[model samples]
Target: MTPQQYHVIALSSLGGAVAAGISDNDLGAISGYSLLSDNATLHAALWYPGSTSAIDLGTLGGVNSAVEWPNHALGEVVGISQTSQIDPLKEQWSCSYPAGSGFLPYTGQECRGFVSRFNRMRQLGTLGGNNSFATGSNIFGEVVGWAETSKRDPTCVAPQVLGFEAVRWGLEGDAHALPPLGQDPASAATAINDVGSVVGISGLCQNAVGALSAEHIVLWKDGIPHQLPTLGGSAWNTPMMLNDEGAVVGFSDRPGDNNGNNFNGHAFLWTSRNGTTDLGTLAGDAVSYAYSINNRNQIVGQSCTPGCASSRAFLYQHGTMYDLNTLLDSSSAGYSLIFANDISDEGTITGLAVSGAGSILAFRLVPNGGWSGSTMGASREGRSLPFRLRAGSFGRIMPNLTH
Candidate 1:
């Protein structure tokens, strides 16, 4: 028997008519999204998450900015805002609003030279070097990423230089940079769990005068960096996301994987019980990269399959890997599932689906219930009626689309 069908709920329009005329715009071309409430109305997008539909978190005069959903929190989103058009320095914005409105600023101006708003984009400010980037945010609004600091050292021949370190940000205090691992020149914190653990990559500067292949996976707890041993490799090992239970997922290369210019990397999962477990690639393929992990320990990423046209999205659960396309309703045309960015505790997933126009559209997969059969038939059955999850709660039942 075929797996149960899942309904594709349109959460936002990234490039539709409502989003046109927005300069250099991509509407709901969501890179990441999180459901704040099962009600579906209360959620966060990587960009604007509101009714007007095209209101982006105004950038620092730059054409590009990113929005990410903050875990399970309602009405909160975080992203990087470029501060200037001439000298664009990425600043972190912690955006929050009343339970039902669009995002409004919640923090002061903190400039970090470069930033990547991934996972849960709460800004993790700089150590002392005037630069920081955020990767993830936990339920309490705490954030983890990396920062740069100014350092004076006798080993340095010239003036005092800047150094990079992992960092954590929370309501308890100012942003604090996690300590470095050994003599590695730079370290970055990528993802954080609800209990406050963090993970990322650490490595020496990659250049002629400072070139050294010393990258390793590092974990941080209470603002301290602890090196996580690699799968016997030299180039670099990067951790992407961590679940609430402290299980971390990422990718690493083997010793012989990269010789001269050839490179080979494999996805891996790490936990306290198991140091690191390799998540092999699809049939006859060579490389894989894991990006996100849900609370149920289900891993979502992309892998190259032999004879396949390109890398496709995949979900690994119960020790089995399945192509994400298998979950979609094949009867629907123009729907091409791509990366699965984040999944909620309820098994709902948010990711991008490419249309025939090559535009990326954000989608939310909810249980295939509510309305089924023909649109008019379901509406006549009162199936389009909105159901509230709590007593004294109210919701707007969207009009059934006549198709």
Candidate 2:
């Protein structure tokens, strides 16, 4: 029998060849990145994969853009980009090779659309408002996010002022708010799965008591909103990510479990098959929060140790939880695992690592015996160091992994 090999794909500061940005200025090394691959080539930004390298998927004139590689859909990347120099807000951009790439402007906008072989990024306008911000997209090109409205309350914040509403942008550019849960205020969809389900927080804008009015974890499916049952105590509940199978993961507060002020939160996984199950914390830990989950049902998040002296990244799979820091290079010091934002279908984890200087670097963890590379020393002045992996080694890393 042959042993399976895994590769950890991560991007850290090789010293100082800082990740480049729109102004040609260095914007810290890779703190995070999403893999964008076609049938032949795998494209990803160096943390903030900008418009310069790769194919120059231009922005909306902002400093950076975001990319999400759908597990079911290969060879395409969906993310928000700056479209016009006049108003540098986020417009959509799809990157494909040799396709003469460009921007996806909001419908009814004065800007012209660019050409890309992938799905056209049709800007979803706000709810009776002028601006809309997109956060997530599925393989079907269904986009979800919050939009502004014509009715404005001077006291409201940016998203709220726009009447922050979870909206779906599809064949129709006119954004429709996800049905609110009877709360005077509304919600915003943070992540959507291939099954057409959206997850996020729904709550009131403000309360006279100086506390958040009401916040609930919500799931929107078939155009209807269903509030996922909370863990008990709560002034708020937020769903950060959801998998295609409708398995929603987030943090919630349970009453009487801990002090009311910081309602002790436990990372939870909710599925139609199983209501809401708690993914327990690391040994001797009081609070834990799951930030992202992959299709394999593997969960990733952070947990605070007793006394909160340190918080460590954790991976929960097959009913088992392991600390991520223990799996990394032990010699590395002052390294704090912040948040595990996203996980690739192949088990590649991407997140930020805070160093002693407060510098945050992005990293990818490949399974052992998967990616083979020697660590090269940093360059003079501690700028950049080059560590190379075999060109085609990525596929071998996840040969048997499921999406």
Candidate 3:
């Protein structure tokens, strides 16, 4: 199907001003997070194929929950949720974002990775620390993400004295820490395939975020961590998603970003055959990032123009990067599609979009086999991109270390 056959579908939030884009898709539903009406907390939510109202996946006895990845074949969802226990250190976990005008971290309550199925949620315990985050899962119910360990890492920033390690959880909810690269203090598993292969970042425990901490992109096969080459920088070499064919796609800093503080990396696709190939930005853009790669090897992400003053969503395939907005119908209203988070093998995509009224909203683009009568549109620049999916706020979204 051509992109012209695609149509936009807006999602509903839980009476809040913001609704993050869908992160995973099931046979008939999509999962993500939305702010609660109370405006202080968030809740994991699911939307049926055509329903406007979302089903709230209640939290694990706390104020927040998120669905980062859902195994559509198994009907299971994985993510992080807050608990009743308050964090003694009051550290802002990596998933935290600003709520409207007030910035809030997932503080106070201790959060943990979780698996939910049949409407029942089970927490995936940490590696002797207070928090965990689950990002991807396969049909086998095996989950991959990161968790805090008992060790107090010197590399970790203030209040976050405990280090974190990438973890794989069994169907029974047991945590298994993945091996790091050469005794590195921290690692995080972001995506896993049904074949039992997993990929993520191997880095220091600095701030528990992948930004400057990630030094290597790693793929684990048979429990052995193998280093994947970067575009030639020492930091921000992150792999955001991996497909079953062993193709990994993400973003990595170029050799010119050797300063160590820069995270402005170009999108990269790595394979056992090609090693690593830089996927350049859209026309007039300076940086790009890939968040998801389907089995067909089609990739989707965001590209920012020079100086990051403007951004656009992109779909890359067959060695060409096309602006997703450009693929929309030429007669449609102007909608700035900013960040493309994930694309299903069926050619459906979900991400953040700015409407004609300048309101930020999560949107889905479904490719139909035939044209549906809806007109097309043109792309407009100047809208801001978010650093993380914020509630009622628009900022620069960082390279998705948590996803």
Ten consecutive residues with minimal summed lDDT in candidate 3?
391-400
TM-scores, all models, native as reference:
0.67, 0.63, 0.88
Off by over 4 Å in 3: 1-4, 69-73, 97-104, 258-260, 306-309, 330-332, 370-382, 385-403
Over 79-119, each residue of candidate 2 has an lDDT whose tens digit, in order, gives: 44433343232222111101212222122222221112233
At residue 358, give the lDDT of candidate 2: 53
Instruction: Write the residue-wise lDDT of candidate 3 on 1-403 in tens digits.
Output: 3344556777777775556564656464677777666655667877767776767888888877876543433687777788888877665555553212212234467878888787678889989988888888887889998988888889887656788889999978888999899978789998897788999999888767655567889999988899999988878787888887989888888786764565568999999998899999887677888888888898998888644556788888889887777666544346777778787777788776767765556677876566455543344453565443422111234222222
**What's model 1's overall lDDT?**
0.48
Candidate 3 residue-wise lDDT at 22: 48
The candidate, 2 or 3, that scores higher on lDDT is 3
Error of 1 at 189 (Å): 0.8
By lDDT, rank the candidates, best first.
3, 1, 2
Q: At residue 80, what lDDT does model 2 achieve?
A: 48
1 or 2: which has the higher TM-score? Answer: 1
Model 2 lDDT, residue 206, Cα: 34
RMSD of 1: 13.0
State model 3's lDDT: 0.73
